[model samples]
Target chain A: MARKIDPDQREQHKAAIAEAVWRLVARSGLEAVSLREVAGEAGVSVGRVQHYFGTKDALLLYGLRLAQQRMEGRIRRRIAGLVAPGAEDVLRATLAELLGDDPDTRQAVRVWTAFLGRALDDRAIAEALFADDVELRAFTTEVVGSPLDAHGLWALANGLAAEVACGQTTAADARAVVDHHLDRLLGSPDR
Target chain B: MARKIDPDQREQHKAAIAEAVWRLVARSGLEAVSLREVAGEAGVSVGRVQHYFGTKDALLLYGLRLAQQRMEGRIRRRIAGLVAPGAEDVLRATLAELLGDDPDTRQAVRVWTAFLGRALDDRAIAEALFADDVELRAFTTEVVGSPLDAHGLWALANGLAAEVACGQTTAADARAVVDHHLDRLLGSPDR
Candidate 1:
């Protein structure tokens, strides 16, 4: 009889592997990530990890995509809880999410930064990363209204995230800076 | 008879080593920076490299500090050339220098980013890097005046630098954004 393969089980395994990769990235630099180390960290066989992700490039790409999706999902959930979310609220929430205050967000930022360093050389990653930047710019432009370009807004948010991640600025201070910028770009924050 | 070490030649050798490390970092990520590779790139013996900088940590630290000094020196020269440099002029010039459009500034930013990633795990580097941040904050605060905190300004500059380095935005675009922010903070750019 053929063995049964459960879809949920497979996803859980992939997520575990990704999580392990992220931990390694957070602990060491991106260079520390390898199939052997990831498998060891994830407590799985190297063949199993290879089965799930064919190549290190694919694994890394999946990890990057996963981090982006997790951040987007988080922003969506936060906005959903708002009684009546406005454009400014959406913008504020999105920037705040990128600040990477909490553990999950912090890990995501680490993974993102690692990939960014790599993207400097890898054309494919650069293209994908730039696409994300374009999407961010569009969303920021829509929410903030005219006179505020997405490039500037994106830079400000990312700069804040980098500072927060590097311990140069506290999470609260970063949030305050973002809020101040928002207030300047938009009107005074409601309430 | 023991050969006497000339001060100027020692300085030149160290600068060459640092430059090689910067090139390695710019081409690959921080992990590419090993004593063997650096010595090979610098066209010097590993023993000579170690004689100047004892370990990989010291080598990396020296490279980072050198990059910072080069940037500061460039900014100082630019500011000195201005007939009558105002606060806005100083702020604009400092930010433009960080944008990494030129070859020198581009290499500096790349090395700085690599050090930053490593600084995440290295306590000594983190402390030194934070000190640099503090110094930058003080300088920005002095130039920008009140109502604009140094932390926010630093984040904006770094964010812009990261974006420019990652190819998400052009150097000219980053400069415009900085000027726009300056106008908002301190009145419109004078002359």
Candidate 2:
């Protein structure tokens, strides 16, 4: 006999588990992720983690996808608040997310760099993480609507994020870098 | 009885050990690195590895520093072969290394990201990595000699390198993106 969970409850548990994954990854990279560890971090039983995500790979993939979605949603919500934002404004705001100023952003960037490290050795991870690259690149391209290289723009922001995450540079410097790139790409004389 | 090793032989042994570290890191990320593992990978005994590197942290730090030196040397050699290379030419050659087209470069980039992942969790790693960053950024700034952000340029290249290393993008595409940015940066109307 098993207890049935509502859809909302299931989603909550899943999100909680994913949040645990984030914390673990931020602290110790992707290699630290395991069912038991995630369960411990989430304050749930290993049985519950197993019931939701069958294997470490599945759990990791789920966490990666969920984080990606959350990041996208956050950027979109922020953009929505920009009153009558132009293409450059939107692009700048989007790239500005790479500054990793906030705690969430810093954790996300750490997880991302960890994933990139894993991707080098694991084809499955490479596939799972890069699958969305095309759509993400297309989004940047559409947002820019200019001759600038969208992929390059995304990479630049990512690099800055990595810099901030590794404590190599400050968020202010990262933001300045993004704004400077935008100034050149959008042909704006002023920031 | 202790045998005195020549300077060149000692340097060679250390380099061999460092190369082993790169291979393991490239294959499985930084979390996979350990003293015994590196010794096995280098075809040496554990005692020998300990004799050379002292501890896992020291081994990793040494490997990282050695990798940095090799990359700088490689880039410098390439620039040296250029016929009447200008500052922009040198910069292009430097950024081009991030395309990760070659095996060594790919392995290096993987190790770099692995270290970045570890840096998030370990302050010691973060300090070692960020310490060199100032010198690297200064070199780029001197090379650029412009209002354009040198740090941003390096980050852009780093991002593209991560893309190629993760199998998200091709070397040719990454090269094009880098070149496009270079064109804009140097105000070169022609490719």
Q: Largest lDDT belongs to which candidate? A: 2
lDDT by residue for model 2 (B1-191), tens: 89876989988999999999999988877767888888899999999999988888888888888887888787888889989887677777777775746678778887887787777777877776667666667867886664347888888888888777666778888888887787767677344
Superposed model 2: Cα runs more than 4 Å off: A1-4, A31-36, A143-148, A189-191, B1-3, B130-132, B189-191
Specify the poorest-scoring 10-residue window by lDDT in model 2 chain B.
B182-191
C-alpha lDDT score of every prediction, in listed order = 0.77, 0.79
What value does the interface RMSD of model 2 take? 2.0
Native A-B interface contacts kept, per candidate: 0.42, 0.79
Cα deviation in Å at residue A106, candidate 1? 1.8
Residue-wise lDDT of candidate 2 within A51-145, one digit each (tens)? 99888788888888888778877778878999888766776766666574667877887787777777777788777767766776786788666
lDDT of 1 by residue, A1-191 (tens): 88687889988889889999989988886878889999999999999989999999889888777777777798788778888887778777777777746788988776766676777667676675556776667777787664344566677778777667666678788888777777777768865
Q: Which model scores highest in TM-score?
A: 1
In order, what are the TM-scores of chain A for the candidates?
0.90, 0.87
Candidate 1 on B1-191: residue-level lDDT in tens?
89887899988999999999999998886767789999999999999999999988888888877877888899888788888887668777777778746789987776666666666567777776666776667777787664335667677778777667766767788788877777777778754
